[model samples]
Structure formats: structure tokens, C-alpha cells
Target: MKIAGFDIGGANTDLAIIDFDQGGDIENIKTDFRYLPMWMKNEELGGYLLDLIGEEIDQLDAVGVSMTAELVDAYETKKDGVLDIVKKVEDTFDIPVAYVGLSGMMNASQAISDPLQVAAANWIATSQIASIMSQNCILVDVGSTTTDIIPIKNGLECARGRSDFERLGTGELAYTGTLRTNVAAIVDKVPFDEGWFRVSSELFAISADVHHVLGNITTEEYSCDTPDSAGKEKEDSLRRISRVLCGDLDLLSTSDIESIGDYIYAQQSLKISEAISEVAEREFLDEVITTGLGRNILAARAVEMAGLDFTGMDEFLTPEECVVAPAVGTAIMMEDYLSDE
Candidate 1:
């Protein structure tokens, strides 16, 4: 059976097309993501999904979905966001559509009945994948806009918070991310010119700029939109990062730019590490299984700072595959849902 799984996040929508053999083994998989800010383009979702899955729609057996876009301010309430997204998905696809919820995969009716359960449960799908490798570990998923610190014990998720709001209180969610997070939110001060420089709390740049200037991500890997809507060039990122210190490339030396970017990168890693420590101390787990676009750089550094045994999902999945792991897990869960049905 062939299934298409979607992880519809607020900033990007990821898709995984998995072809499964008769015995339930995955035969092939193709994954991709599109930058679609839900706050601005929420209504264009249905068409985008169809376009993303173009040419293969006729051969698809079913569709599966996991989303975090409900938390976007585009909707007045999470319920309203869920219902609207669900309607778009329902209207777009002709085959069976399953929503990955906090409990398990559910049909549209079940999803409609309880929207909050499906609000931010994409991490649950990733945990399902993590549990396959380690029954006891924290799954640290650092995506474009947020990080999820999930604990799994005995092959089941033991997350304390069911909602994003509650997860923040439980230290299972960190608002910092790789490409889209505001630089001001990560650190207010940076090192430059042998002196500590306080940064402007404006959205002058994003984490992508820091990573790009530091060579953590290439121009192509800076997948999301830039803070200043500038070109995704090394020099452009250098300029953006310079602005965080209330300067420009003309004023800041190359070494100064590197120092500021490196400092911000370290502080961002600390932010995620602090959350990992909190979840680890609470769940009593010493090992971490990592995935997402930031898995290698941000997640890996944070795991090291947390002082835990770390394992990258790259052991079982390629680095590219790790980018949309929740989507891959959503496909697996949907296959399981089909068998159960």
C-alpha cells in the first residue's frame, strides 16, 4: 500500500510518501517540505497539499495528517484552527484521511469531535518512531520554529503535557528553533570586539542567520524565509546578524560577525539544553534520540550540554529523512490504522 503522510506545522508543511510492501515493510520513501507561514497563508493550504502531492494522487491509497498549525494566531482558538485545517484536508483528498492525535490515529469525525488532542501531536508520531529504537529515552525534535522534548518509557510516550501551553509549563516544549525563531528571543547580548555587546530585541534576524554565518547551514539549507526578506547569501546573513548588535557589515569586522553569531548559537543551544535537563530530571532518562532539521547541530549540542547519552535518528534514517520524521511516522501510524480497520 502507498500512503502520503503530512506534518502540517505553522511555518512549514512536510510530506512523506511511503510505499509499503505486503508484509508491512517500507519499500520506498520520499520526503519534502514547503515554507508556508500559516498565519499569512492559512487559506491556501488545501491547494498546496494537493500540489505537493501532485502526479501521485491517483495512485495514493490513503492520506495521514499531523499538525501543529492550530497554535498559529491565525485562528482565534485552537479548536477553530483544527476544524478549519481538518476541513481543508477533508475537502482536498478523496481517500481515507487519518489525523494523528494524542491518543492515536483518528478519522475526521473523531478529529472534529476533539480538536485539541490533534493540536500538536506531531511529536507523538516522532516518539512512535523513537520507541522502535529505544524504549526508554528522551526524543529531542528541533524543528524550524520549536523544539519538543518528549520522554518515552517502555515503548510508550510519557509526556506530561497534552497541549502546547501545558508543555511549556512541563518543560517539554521550547519556543526556540533553527530557521524561523527571532534572534532577540534567543539572546539579548552577544560577544563582539572583545567586549560584551547588548543586542536589540528586534526581529532583525533569525537563528538561520547565526547558523549560516557560522557555517552550520548552507544558503540552500536555510529553507525558511529570512527576517529581512533578503537573499539567502552568506553575506546577507552576516549583515542580518550584525544588525542584532545595532551595526552593519560595514561597521562590524568579519571576526566580529563570527563572534556574535557563535555566541548566539551557543546561547540557543543552552536554551534547548536547559529544557532537555528539565525533562530528563523529571523522566529519569539519560539517553536521547534526536531528529529534525536542527537534529545534527542544535539538538546534538543541546544533548551534549544536557550530559546525556545521545543517539541520532540518522542511524536508522538519513539526515535528510530526519528532517520530516514526524511525517514518516505519520505514514507508519496510518498504515497501522489501516490494518486495525
Candidate 2:
């Protein structure tokens, strides 16, 4: 059987495809996964998403979807986008569609008691690995709009608080990210031509562009909100950086751009480290497992600041396995139901 796991985020959509000959564990299957930035073009996101499936969309036997689309600003209308996408899958391929709910140890009725509690809670990949990686740890998942510092006590995901909104204020939420952070949200001051200038509070360059200039983040992941990013020139980078800082390239030098990017990286690093420490203080976790895009950078900074050992989600699984872990983990938890023949 062929199975696909879809993880929809605010900035990107990740899809993992796996194939199993007989009805066996998903972990034992071969898998392929890719992260695509489809959030920038919200209007064409659905079409762009379909394009990602390539030839696999037509041949998959079963598919499951886990989404964080509700975090989008236009969520009021696209709240059902996930369901709509699922409907497209059903319509195109005539395959089974599984909407992963936030319940591996409980019933759907109990899990739905708090709907927004849903977020990416349906993902079983990190949870499954966490159970084995570290028993007492905090899992820090940093995506676009938020960073979830979920406490894992005795190999289970403990509730951080009452509601998601509360979690947003706490370190459980760090609205800054590597690819899509607003520069104004990070620092108010910018040094240009040996003078400090205030930055604009508008939506300009993303944290990705800043990191790209500083060489902290890779060009591969420099997927900011730049138009036609695939063809962005050095001039474009300079312009984007200038807008982010509320300065022009003529007013600044090449060194200024690099400095601004470094500053952004530093600010982001501090925020992540602070949040990780908060979860550790509250839960008294001895270990922390970091995942998502900013895992390595955040973990490195966290280790230096907190004097704690940090582990990556990839450390416990193979490259292919790690890519599909969340989706495969979700499917693994649903084994009893899917295999109840």
C-alpha cells in the first residue's frame, strides 16, 4: 500500500510519501518527502500544493492531512482548506482520506474538546521518536508564526496550558522564525553607514533573507516573501535588506547588510533560547529535543546559554525515516483502526 502524510504550516507545506507491500508498519517502508513554500501565494496555494504532488497524487493508495492553516491571517475563509484539499485528493485519485486527529492514546471525542488544540497535534512522528529519544524532555518545534515548546514528561506530551492563545504569550510561542520573521519584530535599531537608524514596521524582508546575507541560513532555505525568489539578484537582496531596515543600499554598504543579518540571527537566537529555558524551568526537563527548520541553530544557542545537552529529531531516525516520521508516526498510531479488517 502507498501512503502519504501532509503537514501544512504557515510558510510551507511538507508532504511525505511511503510505500508498503503488505499491511505492515510504516516505519518499515521506503519514503520520500519535500518541503515547499506555498504560503506566500495564498491565493494560489491550493494549486501550488497540487503541483507538489507531481505524479504521486494520482497513484497514492491512502493519504492523511495535518494542518496549521488556522494560523493564517485569512483563516476565516480557508479554515476548511485542509478539508477542501482532502476532498481534491479523494476526487482525483479515489483513495482513502484520513484526517489525523490529536489522539493517539484517547478517543476523538475527548481530543476534540479543544479544537484549536488541534494545530499540528495530529502529527505522531515527533511524538513517536520522542518516546524513545528522551523520556523527560521538552520538544521545541519552531515553524513560521510560532514555536511550540511542548513539555514531554514520562514519554508523553504534557499540556503546556489551558488554551493555544495562552501558549502564544508564553515562551511556548516565539513568533519569530528563520525564513519568515519580520525584521521590525526582531530589532528596532539598525546600524547604517556608522549611524544607528530605526527600522520600518512594515512587512519587508523575512528573517531568511537576513540570515542569507549573514551566511547563517542557507540560500536553499532563503525562502522569504521575495517575489520571484528563484531569480532574485544581488540587487534584489540589497533592496530587500534595505526595506527591512528602512534604509537604502546607497545609504549603507555591503558590510552593513551582513551586520543587519547577523543582528537578526542574534535576536532570533536569544528569543528561542529564552523560550526553551522557560519550559525547562516550568517542567524541570533534563533533556530537550529540537526539531523543525531552526532546530540546529536554536539547539546550539540553547546549549551554550542553558548549559544543557540538546538532541535533534534526526538523531533517532534515518534521513528518509526522519523526513516521514511525523506522517508515518501518525499512521503508526492509527494502525489499529486502519488495519481493523
Candidate 3:
């Protein structure tokens, strides 16, 4: 059987194709993640999603979807966003479409009726798959825009909350991310010239700039639209980071900009570490299953700083699968559901 899984977000759309035999073993998997920026192109999302899947849509036996795009400013409310996304999937695909949510797979009708359960529920699908690998582990997924600190126990999802708001309250979600997060949000002040100064709260530079300057992500991996709308060149990254201090490259030396990057990266790692500590206090998990684009650089360091064992997603999946685990999990869950029927 062939299944196509999609994780649609405000900034990016991720798709995973899973081929499974009758015995439920995965034969092959392919993943594609694109920077669609749905907020600006909401009207054209249907076409974009179709283009993302391409020829694979014709051979799919089932489709499963999870989304965080509802929170984007393009939609007035999450319900409207969910309904619109579901409609687009229905219009694009001929086969059955399952919307993966905290409660599990739901048909388009069920999903539309209970949109609240489906909004921003991609983490549940990823956590469900992670639980199958290790029961007593925290799933720390540091994606492009947010971090999910999910606690799994006894091979079951033990997250303290379901909704994004509830998850934020319980420390299961952190708005800080490795790519799109603003540097100012990561640190209020940074070290420069043997003195500490408050950073400009403007949208000067994002976390991508910090990682790029620190060499955590290559120039190509800095995929998001830059704050200055400039190129992703190393010098361009430095200039953007310098703007965080309300200065230009001429005013701040390369060493000075790198120092700021180091401090912000450390602070972002500490942010994840603090959340890990909070989830650990309630769950007693000693190991973390890290996934997402920042898994190696940010997630691993945060787990180490928090005194927890780190398990890279590559241990369980290929490098391609590691970054798109949620989409793959959605397909995996759908296969299991279909097999049971």
C-alpha cells in the first residue's frame, strides 16, 4: 500500500510517501519539505499542496494530514483554517483523507466537525510514533518555528495538554525555534565589547542568522525568508545579526557579531533545556528522542545541558525521515488504522 502524509504549517509544507507491504513493513519512504509561506499565499495553497505531491498523488492508497497553519494570520479563526485545508485536500485527492489529530485518525467529515481537535495536532502524531520506539522518553522536536516537549510513558502519549495554548501552559511547547525565531526573543541582551547591552526588539535578525554565523547550519539550510530580505551569504547573515544591536557591519566587528551569535545560541539552548527540566520533573524520563531540522545542533545540546541522554532521530530513521518525522508518522498511523480494518 502507498500512503502520502502531509504536515501543513504556516511557513512550510512537508510531505512523506510511505510504501508498505501487506505485512505492515515499510518498504520505502520519500519526503519533501518546502518553504511555502502559507500566510502570504493562502489563496493558492491548494495548488501549492498539489504541486508538492506531484505524480505521487495518483498512486496513493490513503492520505493523512496534520496542520499548524490555522494559527497563521491568513485565517480569522482556526475552525475556518481547518475547514479550508480539509476542503483543499478533499478537492485534490480522490482517495480517503484522514486528518491526524490528538484523538487519532478522523475522516474529513469528522475532522471538519471537530476542527478544534485537529488544529496544531501534528506533535501528537510524531509523539505517537516516537512512543512506539521508546516508551519512557521525551520527544523534543525543535522544528523551524517551535519546539515540542512531549512526554511519553509506557508506550503511550502522556502529554499534559492537547491544545497549543494548553501545551504552552504546561511547557510542552516553546515558541523559540532554530530557524525562524527572532534573536531578540531568544535573548534580551547580548555581550559585546566587554559590556552587555539590550538588543533591539525589532525584527532585525532571526535564529537562522545566529546558527549561520555559528556554523550550526550551512548557507543552504538557512531556508527561511531572511529578516532583511537579503541573500543567505555569510556576510549577509552577519549584517542582519548586527542589526539586532541596531548597528551595521562597519560598527560591529565579525568577532563581535559571532560573540552575539554564541550568546543567543546558548540562550536558545537554555530555553529548550529549561523546558526539558520541567517535563522531566513531571515524567522522570532520562532520555530524549530528538528530531527536526535543529535536532543535531540545538536539540542535542539542550538535552546534554539538561543532563539527559540524547537519541538522534537518525538512530530510528534516515536523515530525510528525521526532519519530516511527523508526516511519516501520520502515514504510519494511517497504515496501521487501515490494516486493522
Q: Roughly what TM-score does model 2 have, to 2 decimal places?
A: 0.80
lDDT by candidate, in order shown: 0.92, 0.61, 0.89
Worst 10 residues of 1 by lDDT: 188-197
- Candidate 3, poorest ten consecutive residues by summed lDDT: 41-50
Question: Which residues of candidate 3, in runs, are more than 4 Å off?
Answer: none
TM-score of each: 0.98, 0.80, 0.98
Q: Model 1, stretches more than 4 Å misplaced?
A: none
Q: Which lDDT tens digits does candidate 1 get at residues 1-341?
A: 99999999998999999999988899999988888899999999998998889899998999999999998989999999999999999999989999999999999999999998899899989999999989999999999889999999999999999989999999999999988889999987776666778889989999998899888888898988888888999999888988888889889988888877888899999999999999999889999999999998899999999888899999988888899999999999999999889
lDDT of 1: 0.92
Candidate 1 global Cα RMSD: 0.9
Q: How far off is model 2, as Cα RMSD? A: 4.0
Q: For candidate 2, lDDT tens digit of each residue in 1-341?
A: 66666666655666666665565644444444334443444555555546766777777666655665545665453434444444443454455555555454223333344444345553344565676788888776655445667777888877555335666665666667666777778888766667877888886776766666766555555544563243345556667778766667887688778877776677778887888788788888768777666666555675457667778777865644543456555545444345653
Clashes of each: 0, 2, 0
- Predicted structure 1, TM vs. truth: 0.98
What order do you get sorting by lDDT, best first? 1, 3, 2
